[model samples]
Target chain A: MKRFLLISLIWPGYLLAQDNARQIEMTQLLLIKNHQVLSGNKQPDGLAEHSETVLRKAERYRYQGDFDKAVPLYQQAAQLNPKRQGYIGYVHLAFLHDYSRAMQYLNAYDALTPTFDDIEGNNPVSYYRGVIYLKTNEFALAIEQLNKSIGDIERKHGSEWVNYRYYVSRARAFLATSQPQKALDDLDKAVANYKKSALAYYHRGLALVQLGRTAEAKSAFQDAQFFFGAKRVEALQAGQAVIPEDQLFPLYESEIEAAIDQLKLKP
Target chain B: MKKQGWRNGKKYALPGLFLFGFWLTTTAQPLTRDQLTGQWIGVHAELNNASLCPLSTYLDLRSDGSFYLGMVDGKAPPKVMTWAMKAGQLRLDVLTYALDLISLTNDVLRIGQDSPMLFRRFQEIAVDSTAAFQTLNGRVWETDSLRLSLFANGKLLWENCQTYEQTVHCWQLARYGTAVFLVTRGNAHTCEGDYKPLWQLTQSGKQQFRAIGWNGQAVATETFRLVRPLKLSEMPPANEFQRCANCFDGSRYSVAEPFLRRYQPMLYDIRKAFEQYYKPVVASGQSGLVQIQFAVDCDGRMGRFLVKGFDNDYQAKSFDPQLVAQLLTICRQKLPAGWRRDPLTDQQQSDIDVLLNVRLSNGTITDVFL
Candidate 1:
């Protein structure tokens, strides 16, 4: 009877201990999920240090093209420092192409930061916004934002500060809206300003073809091929400017040749 | 007293049964390190929600106890970390994510608490690294629905037999340690336009290879039998420009330029007429470029006039074909009256292709050029 009583008394205490342990484990799991270390040295500074370490690791992963790993780390960093939202937005937009997620991060960034005009200088937000709009097929919005970015750069730096990317992007927007003549003009400006850009020449060829200037289109395609070939060789040697191979160019020499052939057949 | 003790034991029987069931559910059979080695692919079951698209996840457990967790699709790079199993739980040191092991047998690994995810091992074939690229070059690899051809000049032709659509893409070979990646661009059909899929090339058998998708899952099983070897000399040059014989040569169209220059004295009249016709239709505070095409025939008559506005159709409904015709009519009316036919070269006998660009800023003509 005494043994049974003792067992009964200890069993309740054991159950209580088990419950407490389970609670502690659950808390620890939650903390880890939130990117917090469950050490005695836990402090605000420690959290910051942890965030920094995670950010560094994430950047390393990004540099090594391990974006799957980098994205989670970036999310952790953004949670730690809300200011990292913009950078995370750019990564999601440019690398992942997750437009909705990118827009969420960008919206978070916009909520945290001041407006573009109020910032008193040139910022890349407008440019990034323009690119996002372009990718989303909001052509008018893309042009408006891109124009603002170009105007800001021109106002702050000079006309020389207006890079070819802005013109090329705007040209794409023009093309999307079936304004081939305007696209051709912007492409011409892009080629004039940055002669080394194979993208500009490729776009120029598309615009020329749209405008029924097949001969000029052929010339532009040749220029695009020359520059792209040279760049590919240079990238192989120098290991710089190496874009993802699949994203190198949608159109190839055979496609360009086929386009030229089609034009030839068109009376 | 014994009967009383039996009654007490019977009173606690339900709780004991519950505790035993909980233990059985939580505590899984322990897995050995050796059993975990090699590549394992699984679906990310956590994203089971309707809005979330589950991707294939891969776990490459090396014999050395190091692990790489990533997608098989080559969309992103793998995460390198150390892994350990303890007390029927798997722990990843970097991620700090731990899951209770449910069961592991026959190359299938299941882990989780409530909803367990399953992973399967891939049957790997040893590949000869040196001859892999050489063997793959200039060969057509086909399956039931897909045909792929890789050229030496970095061009890849992919044809989808089901869709009957062919896409020309660029390819590059990159190596990191023993892993060889065949990176292909422009294949993804997504809202973000083109996406590059970095495929890990592994030779499965003699003249056969497997392309692992970004989700760390096997996407394609391809077999290659070399029909013809590609010679660099035989490959078509990328820069071969094809010119149509009857196409307009801009340099030979000199008469159109001189004609525009001679009409410069009437620039003010032309600008005024253009502004009067287009000012109301052009949006206020918006600037645009307008290209007007007209033929100055051998008889010197201004005819075949067409106007093209730079503004996108969606932005301004007023800038339509009718507006273009009206603008063209205004230009023709504003042109100088008489023109003398220039001496025709054999190459330049047609109606001259005269393209004039008129720049308008906020409903006023800013500049005009050829």
Candidate 2:
């Protein structure tokens, strides 16, 4: 009787403990899948059970574009569990565009997950870093980072996966450094991959003009106009254009016009 | 006493069995890594706690252990991570995270603890040739004097106005040995008669195409380019053929009518200026159509002005071209400031060709149009 009583009393409690542990584990998995940080005070089960709830709330906030509210929750989740560093880094880099904070999170992620290889070309850390450098006008550093990113992507995903934007950015950097020929080469690749972008043709025109290829420059300018006009018309028709009047016009219209004028005036 | 003890044992046994059943229900069978090597799409049930909307998500796990996770909406880039089945749990490299193996089957996979989400294995279906044909159908290819329209039903219409020949044929596009060939049969009009032509097609670039003969030589005078589609409403009236405004090279102004319509007001203003200055010239028995050629540069400035007189049938009239040019130069200087500028080519201030035709009958200004 005593043994029966003891077993009955302890069995439910043991089952309850197991259920709780399973719940925590499941919540951790959910958090991971959702790209949220796993966190919480360590329970006797060695799982941060509360972190899952925090991450869920953070994700909700992030989805709603409430970054001010979401960032704190993500930070808290990261604090509770260090494993979330990578996801937090991605959120900061991709969503918030906070380079410094993203870099910090990425560094922490690198420290924790030191064995992570970027052989799949899916990792956007280097790409994001390169973009940040480009935006900041650190052309040399931008080129270095973008080179690394492109190399990794080409090796893993083949040349097809290396998008036109990468080439355009590198070309812009080359142009800034006065490497007009290199810029032209990159612009050619960019145009080949995605011909609809007016900016590529515009830059190509600039590069051609720099090289004193007057006829080619004129053709490139005309192409830029054609593509820009087409896109402008498309945007206007779609009703998604913020500025309807400007949407049908190209960026740097005045600059291109001036360049054409200069070319015509050249003896 | 023994009966009472047995009853107590039976009571406890029921509770024990209940606990074991609960454990069995909650603890799912462990899944092997091989079982996960496929694309899986599922719903995240608790994505938004406030709303009951479940967000669809995808998990593409390759045999190489690289996995991509993304929302089904495709708004976000897929997150990449290396995954492996470790110690009966799934370990992801990036997050340094692990997922407890729940339940996995050939079709359905369930993962999570308290509220497990279910996923379905993705199966890819083969695409038929009809789908491929749809991509190339209803497009027109053109060159200087040749136009070829490909229809969805495999009908091809080739018009060569220069040769005064129109060919209607049943066409089939086939790929063999790394080359796409256009095989045509039926009443294809040639100088000789109806014939069949098997032309091997090669794409020079996105916009350009080259058709070669069976002997592997380039087809004579055959250069095909993609034709930009224009609405019927944008086409010029029956008797009026479209040509570039300022040039005599006979190149057509193929831009949409809506684009040209935007400059009507400015062209109207220029007309009024012409009437103010040249109305007297028309009134003085100099009644003829003067063709003025000018370009609006990217800076919205006018340049490269030329003028000549032509009769109603578009033949060069007997008026002195230099006199018309001199008059146009004077009028160009007096032209108004409201050229509006071509928005499309304005960034580089691309030169927009403007052609004006001023008409006069019996020394009176009759009409003006572009």
Candidate 3:
């Protein structure tokens, strides 16, 4: 079976070689340059643009740690295209761990549309900034930023319309600030918004533990364990992206189990 | 066609003539010095059937039996070498290539057997450099089609003005005879594989400059008028520009043949050797994956042991210090027994990165992936 699988993997290489055989011409240099800048795994000539093509190209360089090429391309894309600024900021905060640069881009993006909340990829720009502040341990700033994403929506359209992940993010900030009651309030709303949210149950367990509700905390942790497993299987079966809340505040299956194990030993 | 004659003695005459013709085409033919004397422009090098590395390097084969191999842009220094056709084989410097492997057809020269490099005869077009430089240097130029900024420091910014999309590159003026070619290529951060475009300057003035070459698609004349002088602060971003960026940097070494196949028995032996040396450190909260990556040179010497750990979440986490130290010690000490003095090392041409990902549960090795 292993031998067969290896052969299957290598069979495409021969097909690829046969497919790429073309008569060489001088004009094909344009095609070569286009290939290098677009779909190639090879190094690019740093031909940046303020379009989707350039943004995707910059992402490739950034992922490969080719920061010299990546930085200039990203800067150009974000500077020239106002809409791309927030997206770049989100990528910096989540994947690159470049907090300062993320803040800079996010600030610039927010300035463009001050009155309205701006969406960056799947989440709001303020939500990404809140996660960045949380990562840096600026609990107060994190909560303030989170409120702009969650509170503003809750005021206009009520809590039901807001994403459950936003509440979970704010709840994490509340927990960091030792505001257990506020954390519990947000987690409850998060649970109400999405009943099967493992993140909500996990944070609820944390808040309950903080408030000395041991039995309830244990139950919340059990619910978290059940939902976490279900979510993992669902994501695998459907090929869905790993739960987005995990990018902001990681919640592992082992962590929930560890909490349960610790609570069991507390007797 | 001669099958009936093959049964008779007369068949030998036809077969002999065919053999002679094949020999003439394959070996008897010798390439003349005059045929290869002119400048050749690089096209593309076929590394394999699937891959083509774009070539900007030109070969200037002088009539004096000497040659210069370098970039067409004149950005890099040329390498001078002596060339001669000896015994129907082409010799450049100390390297000799088989006669059958080379072909010159319609002014295009194809060289080499395994990885064929193709080059076309260059036509030197004349244009005044002084006037071109006067219009180009330290100024921003804009056209209906494109936007270009040429800095005095030899840096350039090119943009598709129609779409407001831009790219940063290095530019230089090369004088081929009386012609001034505006050469634009990748910066230091980019690889040599990046394509370099040579634009022939056709006309130039204080207000406008015209060039005919690759306009991102086909060879065409593009006219640009002066927009403004480049500010002192404007320059190509040189932050973290590595002269030669490591190709393997930030990339995981995939398990490839013949490293995995030809060395399968050796790899199995190495894995067995690890089982004997690795002593699992039993402790709580140590369950996850640990990947130990190292490089083994052609001489069977091992070095650069790097260890990375991830918890159940797959997030970057450090394993227990003692556990990590033990793994490093095994890699540094015990792993060499399987590699050092191995006969397989003799066949290797380059150093290869080896990876071992181990799954641990409570610090006990559950599985090992080579």
Candidate 4:
């Protein structure tokens, strides 16, 4: 028994040493071995895996744009866990860009928490609904939805605690309705919340342009340009696949430049 | 008092502190050259808190200090670069990663912070590609979900029998010792990520052939039944097959510029055009999103259009032909003439890939996702 125990303990160390030596020797050979190969056994039954597993699997397919395989799995995930509905709704809103369907899922998710605003992914249900309404060009409905989210938060914790993007989104809605004064108020709040936001400055320029404040519009556009360049540099330093701030707001440097040029022409 | 203080503080404390520091440094030691020099298969990249997308890429590190990186099933030649460990930092090509950013355990290597890329140690199984070619060349095969046609001229066509999505690719039977892999390489805008899954040839017969490959989630053996022999009259349509002139890194160009800012006005016009051209089919229970993905070549010509449909439940389904055709026309031919040239030609930019998703309520277009 002692001999067996000794061998068991020594065997692992011996094996590890051998592995290291073999790796070193293989390195010397320098033979080009193709590392690309499908390495896995047959897929396990979906019923055996957890809901999280199913959802992850669905995400893999969706990421590749294989909706034929992704959809049924997403359905399976929702059936497995009701809380996943909110995430699925977010996917519809953000990734799939299906606003109506997103609203349906968001509504379904919100029904679970009837008394209070339900959180989906990172944002609340009202926030997603507002974005959906904005996307669908229902400016009035978007403002109403945005109010539900922004008002409740501002009431409790004051405007400082609310996300600056929420204010920007509401400002966008106000701008669409020619409510330039209200838009400016929201823009001021957005700027105060996050001073370096290129998105806020760009929209602020737009509001100023609408109010015919040509000089202020030009200055806001210039600020927007500077911040946009700074943001791009930050994005580049963050390396590949880092989404830029301008991309999140779906704004463009060209738009700011165009706004500036138009304002210059006005003067 | 001085002697007592030295005994209590300096003597034991100095030695003890040195030993503790030594242990800490040794425990967090950088990975040795031997541990890193090997073949690796990409597992997946962790994106945004536990969400993983399969990474179909491979890394091969040689003792000669040179490492190769490429898509697993790609025809694009592998990129070769020298690598070394310097000052406790691991260098892969030009990108220097801190020692803490990389970890290897039980044949798995992970690199990076936040979205760490995972790779599994690859064990090569020798198989003759010449033998594999004899079985697969110049033949049409069919499975339940897909139909594959391998032409003798190094071209293959993959058709999703269910979705009716047809794609053409360059094919090669690659040998790694005793294992044979059927590699299919796609164009710049191919949805399946530069290339499809690497299929390892397992069994072969006159009428049926089987290969182990990824089937959406996990590896499964797909049996292909011989449909027919490839005819010489069938020509590979180079013109029809859209490819980017200079799309070296598959995701780099597309992901960096998901949408060209200069095309913003044109994009708006396209949306307006779609809504105007759209003739509502007015079918009951046919509400969904139709997503169209296409590529604009470096020369500013758009081609290689792929369409996908999802119902109100976000389930995959087909939409009315009228709705799909009208949208395709606007995207393909109805773009404003100015979109044909890259706006920022002075900077020498590459091709741009665009994905347009439109939500349909019955037959009417409701929303355009840019």
Candidate 5:
């Protein structure tokens, strides 16, 4: 960070010495005024309209998975109006999935704002890293993180997605590393969230293989195939991506390996 | 309550996803991993404890955390409800059959109201009931290590040690419970070869041998717990003696061959090592009476062969003691798997008896004397 600060200082033809000092002073003043000066007040009508337009365009690029295109525009909107939570939230969300990266945006968010936007905005980065744990193979840890994600989410919206993601993720973890039977029990509950989930069958197949029922594994592979062709096709077309069975199972990995391989993929 | 915690988390993340909402509608594709989730195989349940122990059985736990024995005696239908692990303690229970042997009380009280003691014992009296069941009746096979107990009469010796190589004595073995114990002792006049007990521990509050000799100078003192072999299909490939992790750890492993002596005060003619590499020559042709004197060492290695009466120039005859020594060394290294090394003495000394063989052979091995 000192290196970046030094580079920012020695850089030629960049923001002038006074311009840099002026910008820092402006940021401090805005924070002190609690955004009252920035919002519900003196902004020119055209400035609000322009910021809104830029925010929408940035979000659209982000939706298309064009992070590079979205980053610069989001940065522009955030610099133009540092009070908008959505601007920082975009970067923070991207970093959240990769526990290590989430920390970076979280630090930026805390440094940039005096009052955090969401109730969870002021939370420690470990809490968000725990959210990343929800997606990892360690189900026990995932439960712990999602449990923490629960209270804040409840204070904001209701429970549902956190619970579902946690349950499903824990189910996957159990099936991947723990005993097949325990995983099966958890999947039984997870399938109820949306029903028709192939993960339950895949986990059941893994249990069967451990139980030495080869014939049952064959049936499970077939059922997994059936669900991918039907329920999962839409996800692929959307580019949100539900991993195809072939990629997850690429070779002769038994049904269990395929499931974990699929779950482990980065979004 | 539907979907619950993830819903709340997603709500916090909702503002972030607002940008991707259009993408969600655009792709219209479902995540395939989530779809195929049910198709994955279940991971095998591993117990936190026995995962490291060498025990063959597992503690089968129910959904409520009640336990049962899994994988018993290599039988499919596990001996149900035999014993259980509850609250970090072992509870043993067995079904009883009314078949009578010599009657004895099942439990012994420690003469106090609170001290209830349990005893489990089995005894077999011999009436000359013997049948050879081992594949190697007179032949010898090589192994990396061996544990043995030396006995002069019926009483066991305290000095027991296992060697990676053969020393002097060897003796025939007698089976004792799940382990094999030496039934005979060798001569003391030869090189300092004798069955020495090496490692000892207390089992059932009494001094017990960990590895003990099963033959003449044979010095094994390991506790060989009875276990059903894993299915041949599941077993790892057999490793060579040289590839063993402990082979290079200074000590050599060897095995001893114990035999019955017909004309001696001693009970066994203990051979230094097994004949895994080359066959032992008990003398072939042109002999009235052949005399062979051999010595047993503390290391269970047989050496110093003096075979008498081969009239013609001898063929290239080599005593396979080196191979036997190697085999004994291998056995010594591996035989301590279930052993409890005696804490006292820093494991420097052992009690062992070495048997020296003096043989007179005509064609077949002559009356062997120990």
Candidate 6:
């Protein structure tokens, strides 16, 4: 029993070290990869430090409500990182609220990174690409991205290591495609993963509604009120079945909020 | 001792403050509400020739933001119209009557004077109508069972027909040998339900002339002119001349037929193309009418045609709105001297409406400018 306890305690540290090393290696590869694709104002920035500074500067501009200025900085940072091009380009594409362009960036990211590789476990970038696809209502592509993110994390750690929001988002994306049956299947598994999340119930209800399961759908939407706070109105009642003009932005803000919660990241 | 003195001074100051407040209310600058309520005479309503009409009316402005136009009576109805006061100018939204009264400077109601009265058709009262108020009209009148219009203009327009790019309607004319008698229509209203033919005041003049019941022939006539069509406030004086023994009634044959048969060579070509493009609503119909609205730009060239609605007496779908749009496209593409653009005056901000009466036969359209 003592030996097992010792092993369990050591396992987390060993795994963390492995992750750190991988992060460093990936950072190096990111810095060296794809030197081409740099824009007009971004050339000859003596690599990583300059790129980091540009990213920080972009963040500052973003703080100042200068989205136009900030986006280019983030884009330059990604180009410099080379390994980050896949994720960084995707992030800029997504946050800048250009969905079609974000998809273009996501496609580039997907091609650069192999389909089988497990990079998204610690990388928030892969999850975001799935989100972009999900927002565009590209269900097949979103599922593909989410599945890869899940598969990578599972390989790195275990099935339990998969990001909770990825599963939830996958389900939501499924619903967006008008395939409530498939989405319901995802939600059933999603609730199993994180029953405490109100989103699981709320989304399950939405899926049920789409599938014509009115009673089940109604119950889920009511339960979701507990998870989503005041924002459940948009989901509980279809506020505006309006089409979204900004492609990268989530059609429903609730999904973006839920994603931020699962990622434990502040936008 | 000093504290007691300061405390006593506060009581003395109270009466002076109360007196000041009373004086403010009594001396405030304002004209009486009644003075502001009546028809403040500003602009005279006139015919299309810009000749002032003899009748006059003022607008009644209420304190509650509702508006009433001047009628002959002293009392106004509950609400005259949806009115808004913008920058001292009165804005009246009219729904059918082709009414416009622009008040000049003298007729303007001074801020402190009696409520201004707008007297329509009064030259002096309507002098400032242009300066203080602008009125738009919308009206619909009917003929016998047919809803004919008095001033050749349609009763209602969706977009500000005045403001939109191209809005078209139909107008017909008559041909007497080489003499082209440009046709004008009087009110759809009649003593007994009958149509009347009111022709233009010669080729140059804006006023219309009425024809004493004529030898109503079945000659084809189509002429559509793009000049600003006039909206008549009253019908022309009815002539007593009548023929007892004739199939052509003064109302129908002398008026409606000649107006409908008025032909345009180019518009007819477009209509013919429409018939060829779409199966005619009336099979074996050799001739069809394409009722279209187009813009006449500053140059004499015709602008595009946007059709609001369409009706075909024969089952002929030749004059479809889509086909009209295409015909208008061709007109813009081909006609150089067709559109006209006037110098930038405060008045002429957009192209004028041109209602073309077009005929279709063997894939060709003849358009008459009215």
Model 6, residue A36: C-alpha shift (Å): 36
> What i-RMS does each candidate reach, in Å?
29.6, 28.5, 16.5, 16.3, 40.6, 38.9
Residue B323: error of model 6 in Å? 29
Interface C-alpha root-mean-square deviation of candidate 1:
29.6
Question: Candidate 4 lDDT, tens digit per residue, B1-370?
Answer: 9899987887688899999999997785569888999888665554332444344567888889998876555434567888887798777765666677788876778776534566777766555567668878999988787788988877778787887656666678866546677776544243222344567677777798887664545445789899999974674464553443211223211221223434443455666677677777788766877888877654566776889888777677888787788889888877655544433231333455566778777677777765
Please list all clashing residue pairs in model 3, or write none if there are none: none
Model 1 C-alpha lDDT per residue in residues A1-267, reported as the tens digit of each score: 453344323322221122212322322232233232223233536566777767766765543334456667888988987767786777666544555567777778777756643221134666667777887789999899878877887788875668777778888899899999989988877877788777788789889888888898888878877886776567656744334222201334444455557767866
Q: Write the per-residue lDDT of candidate 5 for residues B213-288, one digit (tens) a residue.
A: 2222222334433222222243222221111110011111011111111111111212222222223344444222
The alpha-carbon lDDT assigned to residue B181 of candidate 1 equals 54
Model 6: per-residue Cα lDDT at residue A71: 61
Question: What's the distance in Å from true for residue B275, model 6?
Answer: 40
Superior by TM-score: candidate 5 or candidate 6 = 6
At residue B35, give the lDDT of candidate 5.
Answer: 23
lDDT over C-alpha atoms for residue A251 of model 3? 65
Docking class of 4: incorrect
Indicate which candidate wins on TM-score.
4
lDDT of 5 by residue, A31-97 (tens): 1222111222335477556666676667554433234455567666666665454335534343212
lDDT of 3 by residue, B254-294 (tens): 22222322233244445555688878788998987677877
Poorest stretch of ten by lDDT in candidate 5 chain B = B246-255
| Candidate achieving the largest lDDT | 4
lDDT of 2 by residue, B1-370 (tens): 9999999999899889999999998875567788878876543322222211122345778889897775433424566877777765666554432344356655666664323455556544222334334534566777666676766555666566576444455566654334454554333221111123344454444465665431212123256677853332332222211111111111112211212333443444565666677634333446556656665532455655666665543345655444465457645676765453433333221235566656656545555555
Against the true structure, candidate 1 has what lDDT? 0.55
Q: Give the clashing pairs for model 4.
A: B125-B178, B125-B179, B126-B177, B126-B178, B126-B179, B127-B177, B127-B178, B127-B179
Point out where model 4 deviates above 4 Å: A1-49, A111-114, A237-249, A257-267, B1-287, B294-304, B309-323, B333-355, B361-364
Instruction: Write the residue-wise lDDT of candidate 6 on A65-120 in tens digits.
Output: 24446667767777776555555555445333445555555555556756533243
**Model 3 misplaced stretches (Cα beyond 4 Å):** A1-53, A238-245, B1-370
